[model samples]
Target: MPPVKKIVMWLVVIFLLYAIFTSPDSAADIFGSAWDVVANGVRNIGRFFDSLISRS
Candidate 1:
């Protein structure tokens, strides 16, 4: 599991680095997509916690 996690992490890092280094447009797209994903994740987490707190 640890090895798999490490490999996945490295793959993501390498892909991001490649994207950033290869083309500015592609890098911008990648960054935008990543930002969207992170923002959505944070929103979801906040909603979940809020719901939990409200229920309690």
Candidate 2:
């Protein structure tokens, strides 16, 4: 990308991250959502492996 576009993108990302981290509700909501996604992903992967083993 061009230098100006790159700078703008970085600035926007930084602003969003700052806003998220500074706002207590936003930070907690984001953390909770992320944790739920990770937990569900791990559970699904474990189930997949268990099913594979059963089939074999």
Question: What TM-score would each prediction reach against the true structure?
Answer: 0.61, 0.61
lDDT of 2 by residue, 1-56 (tens): 69999999999999878978789798778789999999999999999999999998
Model 2, residue 36: C-alpha shift (Å):
0.5
Deviation in Å, model 2, residue 48 alpha carbon: 0.4
Q: Which ten contiguous residues of candidate 1 have the minimum total lDDT? A: 15-24
lDDT of 1 by residue, 1-56 (tens): 89999999999999878877889797898779999999999999999999999997
**Superposition error at 4 for model 2 (Å):** 16
Candidate 2 weakest ten by summed lDDT: 19-28
lDDT (Cα, 0-100) at 48 in candidate 2: 99
Record all residue pairs in model 2 with backbone atoms less than 3 Å apart, i.e. clashing: none
- The local lDDT score (0 to 100) that residue 46 gets in candidate 2 is 100
